[model samples]
Target: MSSNAEIKISGFPEDDGYWFVKWIDEFRLPHLTTSSASVKVVLQKLGSVDFHNLNNLGSTDIRSILGQRKKDADVIIEIRCPVVMPGTLPLVFIGAIYQRGVYVGRLPTRRRTIALADGGQEGFELSLSQQITPPPGWPEGAPYSLLNRFEYSVIPNIMRSSRCLMINRGEDTFIIPRMTIFKTFYAPHTELAKAFCGGPWNDRLDEVICLDDFESGLKTQKITHPEQWNIILQVRVPDVFAPLLACFTLMSSQDRALL
Candidate 1:
């Protein structure tokens, strides 16, 4: 078996202000990590956003940010500055995501709730109430296979400047700690005890970058390089939200010239 399960994601130009995201996963291999047998999923072509247009339009038009719209695209990411202070003119940035013809959620500097685009508030609560199964085809008897899907909820910390986002399953909860060293901001590994060994703190995942060029606005690759756009995810985990987290990270990275 291969050492990693790779997923390819591509999209429009980063200079256009919006990205058209799509991902493909065959689940052909299993990546053995400290916590579980995970897969490496890479999200490439995280297109850039032109802040120039936002000034002219007076509002961030996400749908036209890519210049041309692909109605079938999986997800769309848009960056906007909703608030500004005397010295912090346009410093605060928020990312808005749209998928399946509806608004998915917003990623802000402070903690906030995420509502599914298609599902209303009731559907959002329902997903958290039940235990979600992982994608099929893992060795059925392994202990890690029993890991439940986590529902990420943002809890506001009234006393602190930034709120806390919690990932919970059953009675266990893991708080997503923030790291500013990446310049892009990233959430270090907190899946299990073993995952803490080599992460952003130790510089294992910080240096990684996407190397492939996106002249075509979209393309697919069979292999992934550590220097290029790639992601490592726990096997059979919540596949839907992984990319969302990745995009949120990229929105702050120096690679996109943001925050």
Candidate 2:
């Protein structure tokens, strides 16, 4: 992969997190940016998670790779704080946003940031900013559509292994992840899809911006840890994210069946 292809990550802009969370009309839409069968929607949770190995931890394979664990491959997330879904983590790189092209979610890190070595002890960490929930109606204070439903969790300590961020949460051998979410207004047409882009919470300004035209926040994750915290980012197409999403179809049953 070229330097540019290596995906650039960015944090919420100091000026206004909206820039980091809202939708961008100018960015190029993905060439194949529709929810297709072979697609996957990449989302975030917190800390670093590996996609290829999950069996070690016994976590099930998340159909919605955007927020859950994967089968066979183990995922580990280390952090200082909780992983607030649909708030801290915004609409990142939407693979379905482009048709064969790619949307880049970048993190223009601060100077003097040291890189973590593979399987290194010191993992990654970032601050968990705000947790804004809009009152009843969405932005413009309109009624909320109920076509597509959404829900997410707060991940206390999710990780692959060895590499992780942490906090002394007592002797709770297993860390519980907290989840929150917003279901989309599902209509086959993109016009209906627009409503799902985002809305305001508690009557606050609908300042959350989507990363791209076709991109929207189905869920968000803001994580904190000693050395590193923040959602583990996944870049994928929406269709591919459906199973993980559990909106259209709940994966718990599927997972039980698998087990």
Candidate 3:
């Protein structure tokens, strides 16, 4: 994280509430070394609201935040990100919604990846419409009230490659497998579980199935306390993704809500 590399957000709703948001990022030197790279920026919702009155609350909040008393909106999520790498690869903005530690639905952004270079700075904008449809696999006719939190990750496709398995059984003879073995890149839930149920708890859990069992325990009445089952979302950029320089400076903004 170079001092020159920073992320900032402005135009947040305050005096005149507006749902629109502008995010700016400045990446220099080490952050822009690679010709192309895949980096994910995650946006996690922290507040917990009552689901029973979700409709009224959502409408009221929208009107209040957007400074439009007459206009009504179901939901609004507009944000921008710096596009360090731009090509044919589309920007994948996915939202994973959860309710009490249970995976419920996913929301995919509507906008495509666009290159906007201003004085050596590059970025793109993401806008979700008011008539957003429920993600596939969501229960038909189910209300959005079931959702408690949102974890959205913006993944820009830059390093695209294909892998092939070549097996040699005889001299000068090789066989290529037609099928490609797919592996899960990353599991956010499992990572959360690991962080929450670490140390002595791991020993007590069964070996055959751990993550499923942990989720089941949380879903069932095994965890009596509601606070115990809370899922905390953390956004971390591993060293593999953003290699840091020894003396580079890093800038970050603290969330006032957390304070």
Candidate 4:
């Protein structure tokens, strides 16, 4: 989960330009308030262009003119920004440039999105190879034996991996994701009722960082936000049938016919 990669800047001529952008905030919007985030901004600047010329690039519409200044020979502008990647919330920008404040070419800030520990690429790193412990009564390899086959995988947010399909023998086995989501600045356990515990807000995020270090025999952890919050463990097991016993039943004929 390398969020702060090279402090990048696009749109401006990569060859030459004096773009001075600094992240002074050690723990905030610009500096990442939590350990899970790393802030980086892409400063867009075209040489000597008026505000009207500095369009969003995607839109053909022009901006209204005011007192524009080219005071600095090099355009000594400072944009303290960060690349925000909230946990579980997939990265989506319906519009370009951050539209929070007066987006006078405020520039779109691309956030680094970290998946929920189980439902994301970073989810399996910690949970995989860790070995799934069977129920207290089952033997070490009993779960594997009971089932025809078992496996796990990581599913990216872009992919729609859910509990929709049924797993047929030797078929329909999608990626099994296990996520550990860190919930920082989270409300106290008492305040959250049981119904709210497993809900989306249970891990209502502060920040999220993806790490490939987990399950790789290494301890590189992906962090996402500003606070030292704990993770709510959620397991997305492979779509497999759970073994169960049923005695003499009237639906036997129907079950056989369906099968």
Candidate 5:
């Protein structure tokens, strides 16, 4: 039997701009205050105008305006989640830039912050140039007998990878084998949870299973009739990784559902 928890982010602004988002989750485990998280920002070219034309904003900080961009290219920004005091709440800062007297929507920042608790750790590196690979030190000859044929049929091949998210806390390494959207009843108490915790799924019982809404995103548009699917994650790690896992899950689902 494993523990279950929910991490939610609210009060995000309704305005459209470059978003500086942070999420914090406090755990009851010893020597652990919060989980390390990361943010992935993808800037796609919408029109003929290049991203370089929107420069000359200000200094490079989270509060600063978005910087320049290369012509005919998409920009991807990755920020390591900051560490705050145990009692501090999470925040999402919206930054807008001014170009030619007109306000630009959003931008990126390069400023870094010091962590109060355990300092800030480097974010998990997710490369867009390579495919999703399995975590290191995985058992070579183990069988993936966890998900049944019917379950495998529903999930895409890319989602079945051995690594979804990885978190490093000192000497302890946490790996999220995989995350997917399924019926609400298929997680926690079902065989899915057991399969994720046992056998080839990492063989660790100290796990954190999180069930969250599938429609969670940073966009302003509200879903007219949202689906009832829930994002299920069987993270073979301590409870501190719950919030970070949830954060990556939402981002990956919204940004790269096909990959």
Candidate 6:
């Protein structure tokens, strides 16, 4: 992706937290491209208190393989704060935003050994820093160095009980909040497919953007109601943090079905 590449991801929600995630080429000209693949994954949850391994609800055959998971694996995204889905335990499947194996951001992990090797314990942490090397195919002049310095965290809306990602760069932090409009706008009904991007509260509602019924042309609307209305999840963040934002958004898209 070019440094100036505008990243706009808009998708229909399968239900509450699960989204029929799709990568849009541009917000103005929202459309899916051949290079882009449809990813169907559930954004598990970031329980109000702790972290868990963000799990994939269905098949693990995620379409886009940025790189191999074996020795040939180019990127390994480790969920610094390991959390697992309710049922799956011990053996955790923590992977998100991987497109054909490319978008995998290596999570910090300890070097394991066949035999017991006593050493510093790998604390549960996901730090975006110099430790994260750029994937092999990254553009030469892109912000490869700056990418490492980015510290990502989840900003929880305790009152609303929803959570969004906050990627910090010095004093500046970009927020990626997913709003499930189906519940907020049409609480009693569940037939509308909507994707809204806005502030954390009602007073800040003026700061909204969207890829839903209100958007122009409505050319990009693919996943319709009955079939996909309930599962729509809209992840809107600044263009600069799109790549990293995808990592977490795909993991935990919304705090709750409503917020």
RMSD of each: 21.5, 22.8, 22.6, 22.9, 20.8, 20.3
Candidate 6: list runs displaced more than 4 Å.
Answer: 1-116, 120-126, 129-131, 135-137, 145-259
For residues 1-259, what per-residue lDDT tens digits would candidate 3 score against the true structure?
A: 2111122222112222211211112222323555333222223332234223334455444334323222323444333333422110111122332332223333322333333335423222122211124556868885321111231111111111212233323242221111111111211123322322232323522211223325444421123455322221124333331111111111122422121
Clashes of 2: 80
State which candidate has the highest TM-score.
Answer: 1
C-alpha RMSD (angstroms) for model 3: 22.6
Model 5: per-residue Cα lDDT over 77-103, one tens digit each: 332322222111211122322222123
| Cα misplacement distance, residue 251 of candidate 3 (Å) | 15
RMSD of 6: 20.3
Name the TM-score of candidate 2. 0.17
Tens-digit lDDT track of model 2 for 1-259: 1122433233222221111111111211222454221111223332123222332323232323323333413544211211112211233322111111223233222233334344333322221222223334557654321111121122212211111132222342111111111222232222222323323222211122112322454333322445321221124223333333233222245553442
Per-candidate TM-score against the hidden true structure: 0.20, 0.17, 0.19, 0.19, 0.17, 0.17
Worst 10 residues of 5 by lDDT: 85-94
lDDT of 1 by residue, 1-259 (tens): 1111221112212242232222111112222333222211112222334332333432224333322324524444332211111111111112433222122333222344544343321221121122344445745663221122121111111112222234454454433322112112332222221222233423332323232456865422223455443344345223443563455333445534422
List residue ranges in candidate 3 displaced over 4 A: 1-95, 122-239, 242-259
Clashes of 1: 12
Native-to-model Cα distance after best TM-score fit, residue 36 in candidate 5, in Å = 17
Per-residue lDDT of 126 in model 6: 31
Model 2 stretches with alpha carbons more than 4 Å out: 1-5, 11-171, 179-197, 200-238, 244-246, 249-259
Which lDDT tens digits does candidate 4 get at residues 190-223? 1221112323432521112112345545432223
C-alpha lDDT score of every prediction, in listed order: 0.28, 0.25, 0.26, 0.26, 0.30, 0.25
- For model 2, how big is the CA root-mean-square deviation? 22.8
Candidate 1 runs further than 4 Å off: 1-29, 32-36, 39-60, 66-121, 124-259
**By TM-score, how accurate is candidate 4?**
0.19
